[model samples]
Target: MSVIAVLALDGAPGHQLTAPGLAFATAARHHHPVAYEVRVCAGPGFAGTGGPAPFGIEAPWGMEGLDDADTVLLLGHEGFRAAPPPGVVDALLAAAARGARVGAVGTGTFTLAATGLLDGRRAATSRRHTRELARLYPRIEVDPEGAAVADGAFHSAAGVLGGVDLCLHLITLDHGDPVAIETERQLFLHLHAQAQDAGGAAPEDGPGAAEAAYNAVTPPGSSLEPVTRWMEANLHHPLTLDDIAGRARLGVRSLTRRFRAETGLTPLQYLLRTRIQHAQRLLERTDDPVERIAARSGLGTPANLRHHFQRSTGTSPTTYRTAFRALVSGITWPERPEQP
Candidate 1:
């Protein structure tokens, strides 16, 4: 099991504790190979099993428990920006050195920041606290508006609800999209389903939310829609810029300029992302070997697939496939709950 330790300090916000706990607890119940072992580990002046918060949690472990965890998570506290207790920073550093993932919820990024793990890494905290965080930790790259960001082994979420996004991201890391999507349906569907509806026709665009975030100023319709659609449909065939330009009925320079103007990414960049997305789906849904998946996803070979997959996602293809398969055998999470 992947041991996950939630570092519970005095005054830590209760919501963050419940957020990840709810997410992984549900995953353990539903997912096979039983992934995460979540324990709330407390610090000085700590309350017993009862956690701080709206849920009235009673944590089972104390600060020492974090020493053996695979991941250490920090929750926001009243004085989160204040320096941590004597051994807290050392413990966090020790965990990071051992390749354990460290994450924080809300202003808890400030607490993690104090430990220097977030230096020169991207972190997201509540927009309300960005300036103070930036001033305090000038080396850390803070995204004030981000829903959540996982850069390398360090992860940060903006606020209370951002905690949900962070937890989902972690689930996706541990079990891929199918399990993560089911967890969403169980926990957040009724509340967020409508917000998720702001998408365009699938053939015209590949996933609207990501595109919008990458290039919010772009217009709705792309002038090169047909070419993009063709690229999406033919990802398995080895493609080059000349092929794309020919499809656009334009010279290389003209196609490049227009595509970049219409979408923030270049033609090849978009193609690469599309191919990677396809590979992710296959890894989640099929038992095919990495070599076959690479060929099907236009990555050409296992070596090539590993190169791009690790670049895009921080983990290798084999690891991703293992995590995905561990989540469920063949169960696809329902799109909506059945009416009672």
Candidate 2:
């Protein structure tokens, strides 16, 4: 089993502390042989945020818990604007030097930044603090619009939901598509249950109610959830408008209209964007050649992938892979579970 050490400092948000364990535990329960041991390591002066009254958090482990961890995640603390507690930066640096993957959530980027590991890396933080982070750390590239960023072994996320995204991304990297999808489904089901318990109307009431509840937790495109899920699953195929429309059981014109209204893009435009995203993931995670990645992403050929990738991200596929891989060259990834 892999060990994930979550460093919870003073004023750590409750959601950030629990989200990683929730995601990793869900993945382990749903996917065989994908076990992860999560250790909550409390830093000096640890406390929890967000409640009627602030409370102390007694973690099971302390800073030394990071020594043998496979991954160390830092939770954003109230003291982020100030220096991290003494020895926190040194512990993070030691963990990273030992080839452990490191991640930060929300303002946790500030804590990670204190170690100097993020000096030349790209990172994401809450939109409200983007300008402040940039002004304080000019060497780091601040991505204001990115929900999560993975530069080599270091990862950082922005906003409240960004931690969930970062955890899911790590799960995907550890396992694969099947395990990640099942984990996501389970998480969504839990959210749905919570909504229902909070007196939210059930989906059986009407499409309007269902869409509203879904959009409340998920990103936009809840109106066409089924179609969007289908599109993502079949991204490897050369899908045309008729094929997509047929899957939705709608006429071509109606499908186009709904797609535009719900997602602010035409059907083909959405598909292209999805394809580009798929190519990006392949480039980031795999050593696949451009031709193979192009086929898998439905772009068909290296030339086509290059043309669209450059147009979309303003970087060539080769350059992107090189830059992303450079920092990770000497790091060793955690061992994968044996397939059953």
Candidate 3:
């Protein structure tokens, strides 16, 4: 069993702290029996978090608790102005030096980056902090995309909500894809599970793919299949209502009408988003030149790719790819459980 130390930083997001713990705990509860032993660590004299769910909970251990962890998970928050305590950073850096997997949730990327451990490494944090994180450490690769990213010893997620996705991703990495998919089903989160499946939706948190919380909510519609497949094939091609409709074997007007009715997005809107997804994947999984990536994903040119890429994800494709390339490679991310 791996020992996980969850760094209970002051002002951490409520959900960010709880999500991974729940994931690890649930894994421990069912599949592997003794999957992980989690320790909540805080600095000396640090009072309770007091925000909400995890805030009121007392830390079971202090800085000393981190000493024995095989993996350290840092919860993030909006307190970018306040740097992580020097001692805490020292401990985490030491842990990483010891070959422990260092993971950060959301804004916690700030803390990890501040340690200089993630210099030139691909990491992610919430979209809100992308510019700030980069402005502070120009070399560290910061992905604004939502999937939790892991490169060598460092790992990071895009935001508080992303914490859950990272947890599932880690579960798949630590345990296996099946276990993670089962857990995601229990959480009622369809996106992560779909991601696990080979034919799942795009990873950009698209219209039909992203949702509120993981719940067994009815899916948006079946048009997802034809739409996603079409996007995958025609990413680099100029997509239109007629183009997609022809691919899906429906009339342009009917395809447009049905896709909008089902997904609440026009065909062009859906096509643009799907193209962005392909571009992101290409950026993360390949070393293709920017122009090549734009051509391959149907974004037209490097300029067009950068333009739409930034608009959707708040960062350049090159920057996102540099940081995330290591994550999705040969990785079959987990998927949602099939409906009964």
Query: Evaluated with TM-score, which candidate comes out highest?
Result: 2
lDDT of 3: 0.66
Error of 3 at 79 (Å): 3.3
Give the best candidate by lDDT: 2
Q: How do the residues 244-295 of candidate 3 rate in per-residue lDDT, one tens digit apiece?
A: 7777788878877776655456667667766776675576567789999888
Residue 318 in model 3: lDDT:
66
Q: How does each model score on lDDT?
A: 0.70, 0.75, 0.66
TM-score of each: 0.54, 0.59, 0.53
| C-alpha lDDT of residue 213 in model 2 | 10
Model 1: how far residue 263 lies from native, Å: 39
Candidate 2 residue 65 Cα shift, in angstroms, is 1.3
lDDT of 2 by residue, 1-340 (tens): 9999999888777777789998998777644447799999999878566332456667899998999999999987777889889999889989999999999988899889888999889998766778989999999999997477989899987745427778988887887665576576456545544554467643332111221111101123256778878888898898999999999899999988887765556788778877876786798799999999999999999999998777664457886565445423633322111100
